[model samples]
Structures are given as structure tokens and as C-alpha cells.
Target: MSKARTVRFHEYGGPEVLRLEDVEVGQPGPGEVLLRIEAIGLNRAEALFRGGHYIERARSFPARLGLEASGVVEALGDGVDGLAAGQAVSVVPSFSQNDHGVYAERAIVPASSLVPRPEGLGAVEGAAVWMPYVTAYGGLVEVGGMRAGDTVVLTGASSSVGLAAIRTAHRIGAAPLATTRTRAKRDALLKAGAAEVIVTDEEDVAERVRDLTAGRGADLVFDGVAGPGLTDLVRSVAPGGTVLLYGAVSGLPTPYPGFDLGMPAVSLRTYTMPETTRDPERLRRARAFVESGLRTGFFEPAVDRTFTLDEIVAAHRAMEAGHQVGKIVVTVPH
Candidate 1:
């Protein structure tokens, strides 16, 4: 066993509850591999999980807190093949944090969750890439069947996943309409490849979408902030289109829009990153799609800030501040 510094929370509360401690890390077990972590990615889900608002509650005290990271293989367990020691890799969000979290100097993770880091991608980019891109690809391409010339409405357009969806839509010849609660991020969203930006606070979302789509409505609506506003997003969808709900940042109860509200013949579905990462075939496709975009310079991960592992509490504070326009990453110094 080796000593490693890890982040843990003993109680459900704010970032103040987090504690960094030294712990023993044992060898990888069957179907697992030991990784020397280089960087850790921050997600709103991690913040939600830390605050006990996530779908999956912590199974035990001193619960771990992370799902994404970039590292190098230190050792491989039995039955784990096709990977070698010293190979650079990125961890996918296929497993629960309760089972394997990545916020540490080293960690034991399932071999199936490993993906070879793309060429020329540094630890920070590797750590930041998978979750957002996979979520966007799975929702817009795989599930929604987004096509060329399609109009996609991306709510919470300032988020990492929302920005990724914008680029992914452009990659597929689709036009992305980005939405933000305020105009503070309007120009940044446009510069990030959004065809248009709609300020939810100043404009009627449905009217803006209709005007942008020439009254046909959007072909797909990718929403991360689900709440009362979902009704307007539902009304913004074209007939036969879909409204994919991926996150609940609003922290409010989302009621299904009744048919009497003139809601179109649309499908409302929810998505999580694990839906794509957990399936081998789906994960394979998602990796290829994202890597290709990266190689061609079509997809560039927008990192809003970086922090040292010791500043985990501050990082979570930044995440909850809800003002960042991109991914937040934490570097694990060896």
C-alpha cells in the first residue's frame, strides 16, 4: 500500500465540509488499475453530490468526491489487458463516485473506465474533455438524431457541456441557439460558436426560438437547467423534436408541461453522462467523435480556471458561483 492525499467529506453541506487527508491506497483488484493522477476535473455534479443534492446519495461517511481525471497507469490488475504501465489515460464517468472517485494523488479505478488520452492533449485538457463532450454527443447526436441544418436550443449556454453542444452542432452542420439567464455571457457564447444568443431574463425564450427558426421551432432543445422554464423550452420544440434534460442546476421541482399548454408533439427525455460512458459501444463512438473534433481543432475545451488540489474547497465554491463560462480543473502535483 502507498499513501495518497485524497479529498473527502464527512457530512452533507457546503464546501466547508470538505477535508483533504492522507490515506492508504492498495493495489488494483481484478478488473481495476492503479493510476497516478495528474489532474482532476470539476463538474457541477460533483458540487451537487457534495451538497447531497445529487441523484445518488453517499453510501457511507467520509464519502469520496470526483468522477473525472487524467493520469498515467502505474499498475494493471488481473484480467486487465491492452493497457500498459506509464500509458496516459483519462477516466470516464462510467462508475459511481461511491465505487471509485478520482480526487486524489493516486486512485484505483475500473479498467473499463479508462480511455487513452488523445495525442497532444495535456492532463488538464484530458481531465476536462470527456464529461462534457460525451454528454453533448450522446444527447444531440446519438439520442436526438441531430442532422444538418437542424436548429438546436441549448439552455445554460455558458456551461462546459452547453459550449460543447454548440461546437458539436456546428460540426454536424446544425445551427445552435444558445440561452443564458443574462446578457453577461452573450458575446462569449457567440464567440464560442453559437449561432445566436438569447437572454432568458430579457426575452421570451419561446418567442426568440420561434423567431430564430422562422416559426417552425427548434429541431432539438438541450436543457441542463430544468425547472418551471422547461415549459417554455418544451413549447420551443418543433413537432417531432425532442427536449433532452441533462441536469437540474435550478434545484427546483420540474413539472411536466401539460398538453393543454399548446406543447408540441415532442418527446421529453433525461440524460446523464453515464448513459453514454457505461455502454462500451456508445462510449467507443463518443470517444471517436470527440477525438476527431479535437484533432481537427474543431473542439477546444474552454477552461475557465485551474486550482491546486489543496484548494478543492475554493474550487467547489467557484463551481457553485455559477458564473464560469467553461470547465474548472484542479491540478494534482506529484
Candidate 2:
């Protein structure tokens, strides 16, 4: 068939507005591969894009928003090698400008964007894996310079990316202290390899860090929630420690007390996964690193549930609910 049925948003607003309809699917051209999408990972960024708050949607209307998928290579375009048909694969959907999105029965993506699926990993897990794993790997190994025995503090521990950071830190022999706003997830966080779990609602997170580290504080901090959350993270870090700001889920800019930061001499920086993946070398390294971790059972994505293509509205609403742990996947099994 030359045409495919897919989900699309004509205008940005709420989940109820995203509609599923038929669209034309063209053959892959030059290093591209046509995939029968088995699973499509859902992320908070996609939610922002749907609501028109994301930077990627700076252009006009009728955008198909999804960034990661896992499936089999149905057909390969010219100049592609070593990749065969019906081979299970996980892909990072970084395609832009007139490309088929992952939230469909079929999608055409670049071969460079596809990576072989790890042994014993299923399509659902593969779909939800790349973004969080790569984000954590890039920040912890490449940007944060996390070392063995170093103490690290991670905020938003229940988040998929945050949990991946926790696992990555453990793999590197660093100490990971996770923070959660709710008590319900404290045990889950600890079981996920967090050395310590701090419930923000019940404890003074920064003070607890001082107690845990004997006042030296943490050596590195990975933060996804900005605003006041960053203030606590800053206070939790050691004098020479680095704080990496990667997201602002609170929708508030970080408030930094300049005098204290300057007096104590701390390093604060921001990072984005796209920036790290922009360089082909860095991207390849990240992909290999994550695949190795998955193969070794060191890294596993938390998938809460799966939805069909027609369930687009409910899927979006579920994401908005904020109760899901890890990644939410949308399956389009044709």
C-alpha cells in the first residue's frame, strides 16, 4: 500500500483534539528504511509538543509528534548495508521535515537512527528505551564526569530519565541519592538502585543531604525539575560538585542565590540530549553504551502501559495524569 493510516494534530490544545486518520506513506529514499511500527514511546516532551509548548513545534500546524519507535525493517533504501528485513530494531526518531512519525502503522526513518535490538529485549521495551537511556548516559558519563565513589543527587527519581540516571550512576560505582515528592514511590526508587531515597514532602531534602554526606554534600546533581527544586539541589551539592539542569517540569526557571553560589564555589550547567546526539560520534557511542547496558541487564526502562493508535486521546490524557512511572508506549501493530 502507498498510503498509511496515522494520528495527527491539526491544532495544539488538548488530547481530545488529536485525531486518527489515513495519510500517504511514501517509499524510503537513500539510506532510509520503512518500518512497521510495533511500539511508539511516549514522553513528556511529546506532551509539550501536543500542547504547543515545545521548541520543536515552533513551526506551523498539522504536526505528527513522536520521537522513538521499535519495529522490524520492512524495506531498506539504497546505500544501506548490514541491516536486513524483518530484523528487530530500536530507533531514535530524530527525523525532521517531511518524515513519517512513529505514532502510525508504518514509518520511514534513516538507517543511522536505527540500532539493533538487544538480546532478550522485546519491542515494547525497545520502543521506550532510547531517549531516557541516552539522556542519562550523555549526562552522567559525558557531561557530569561522574566517578567511582562520588556522591550524586538525582531529582525526579520516579521519572524514566531520572531512574536511568540512577542505574547509570550505580553502574559507574557512584553513589546515587534520589528525591521524590511522594512517599508511595520511595521504596520503588530504592529498589531501582538508588543508594538513598528522600521524600521531599516529609523531609528537608537539602538538610538530609548534609546529614547523609556529613555536610560535604553530593558530588554531582542531576536535576529534571527546575524552580525551587534546583535550590534544594544546589544546597545538596558539595563545594566543587557539578549540577546538571536538563528539564523544567515545574514550568518555573531555576532561582539561584548568586551570593551563596559564588561564596561556596559551585558549578552549575545545563544539557539537552539533542545537543549530545547532534555529533555522530557521540550519538554512536551513546547508542552502543546503552545497548551494552541493556544486553548486560544493567539498564531497563519502566513501561507503565500501552495504547493503540485509536486510543490517542486517552493515551495523551494518561500522560497528563502524572501517575505513570517510566515511559508510556503506544502500539501500532498492523
Candidate 3:
């Protein structure tokens, strides 16, 4: 048995409810691996899970709460192959947080959920890369069949996933039109490889999209903010184009615009990370695609800031503040 400092919340509330406590960790059972954590990646889904707003609620009190992390393999369980102890690895968000969370000094996760960390990638980058890049690749490349010369509009363009989407679009020889609520992030978005930045508050999203696409509208609209504004985003889609609703940071109920707006030949679909991560074949393809992009310099993990494990509360606060331009990482000291 080992003692690990773990983060858990006994109740559903704000970041204030998160508590760091010492817990006993046992040896990895069959098909599991023990990891000495180095860094943890933060996602909005974890925040939602912490606050009881996620699709899956806390199964019990003192619930665990993390999805991705980078670490070194401490030990491997029976029946695990192709991975040796002392190897650098990263945890993919393939399992439920309620079953195996990574916000700790050490954790035991399924061997199938482990990915070998690349040679040049550090712990922080490894932790940051999988969630955003895989999400972007899964949604745009795998699901949407995005190809060269396509026009993709990325909502919440300053986010880590949004930045990854821009890079993925570029990788496929497509043009990425990034959308933010204001001009504060326009230059940054452009610098991050967005072909164009559209300020939602300053201009009509659909009109700007149409204008940018030479009156054709976008071939794909990758939306992380789903709410009443979905109607306008749907309008921004070209005929036979697709609108992929992936996240709900808007915190409001989304309404279907197809019936009310009578948009013809437009398709709207919902996406989540599990759509790719849960399937072994899909995850293998996604991992290969993202790894190739990283190797060729087409994809870079954007980290907005870093915090210590003890400051988990502050990290959550910063995430809720919504000013970050990239991924929020938490470093664990051994």
C-alpha cells in the first residue's frame, strides 16, 4: 500500500469544495497500471463533474475528479503487455472519472488507457495534448470528414480545443475561421493560425461567415458553446454542411433550429470526447493522427497557465473565470 495525496469533493459545489487529502493506494490489479503522476490536465468536463452539472453525476461522496495526466509507470499488473515499468506514459480520458481519476500523486488506471508519451514531449505537454488534439481530430477529421479547401468555423476560438481545431484545419489544408465573443482575443487567435477571427458581439456571425466564405457559408461549424445562439450558428452552415455541437459552456439549454428556422439541407449533430475515446479502433486512429501532427509541427499544445496540486481550488477558479487562451495544467511534485 502507498499513500497518495488526492483531490476529492464530498459535496457538489464550487471550487471551494475541493479538498486535498491523503488516501491509500493499492497495487494495480489485473489489466491495470500504477502511475507516478507528474502533471494533470484540466478540462471543463471535470469542472462540470465537480459541480454536479455533468452528464454523469458523482456516484458517491468524496468522489474523484480528473481525466488526463502524464506520469511514469511504477508497475504493471498481470496480463498487461508492451509496457514496462519506469516508462514515461500519459493517461487518456477513456475511462469514467468516477472509476479512475488522475488528480493525485499516484493512480492505478486501466492499462488500455495508457499511451506512451512521445520522446520530446514533457509531462505538461503530454498531459495537455491528448484531450484537445484528439477532440479536434475526432470531431473534424474522423466524424466530419473534413478535407482540403474546406471552410471551418471554430467557436470559442481561444480555448485549447479551439486552438487545436485551428491547427487540425490547417493540417488538412482547410481554412479556419475562429470566433470569439470580443476583439480581445482576435490577434491571439490569428497568431494561433486562424485564417480569420470573427467577433460574435461586434458582427453578425452568420453574415460574417457568409462574407468570409464568398457567400457560401462554412462547410463546417465546430461549436463548443451550445445555447440559443445555436440558431445563428446553424444559419452559418452552408447547404449540406455540418454543425458539430461539442460543448455547452453557455450553461443554457439548447434548442433545435431546423424546424423553427426551416434551414434546408443542413445537418446538426452532437459530439463528445467519448465518441472517439471509448472505441479502441477510433482512439488508435486519433492517436496516430495527432502524433503525426505533433511530429510535423502542425499541432502544439497550448498551455494558458500552470498551478500546483495544492492550489487545485485556484486552478478551478481560473478555469471558471474564462479568460484563459489555452489549457490549464496542474503539476504534481513527487
Tens digits of lDDT, candidate 2, 149-188: 9998888888889889888898889989998888888888
Q: What's model 1's overall lDDT?
A: 0.93
Whole-model lDDT for model 3 versus the true structure? 0.94
Residue ranges of candidate 2 with Cα displaced over 4 Å: 96-100, 260-263
Clashes of 3: 0
Weakest 10 consecutive residues of candidate 2 by summed lDDT: 93-102
Off by over 4 Å in 1: none
Worst 10 residues of 1 by lDDT: 257-266
Tens-digit lDDT track for model 1 on 194-268? 999999999999999999888999999999999999999988988999999999999999989957676558999
Against the correct fold, how does model 2 do in TM-score?
0.94
List all candidate RMSDs to the true structure.
Answer: 1.0, 1.8, 0.8
lDDT score, candidate 3, position 18: 96
Q: Comparing 1 and 3 by lDDT, which wins?
A: 3
lDDT measured at residue 47 in model 2 versus the true structure, 0 to 100: 76
lDDT accuracy of residue 281 in candidate 2 = 83
Tens digits of lDDT, candidate 3, 1-334 = 7799999999999999999999998999999999999999999999999999998999999899999999999999999999999999989898998899999999999999889998899999999999999899999998998999999999998999999999999999999999999899999999999999999989999999999988999999899999998999989989999999999999998999998887568889999988999988999999999889888877888999999999999999999999999999999998
**Each model's number of backbone clashes?**
0, 0, 0
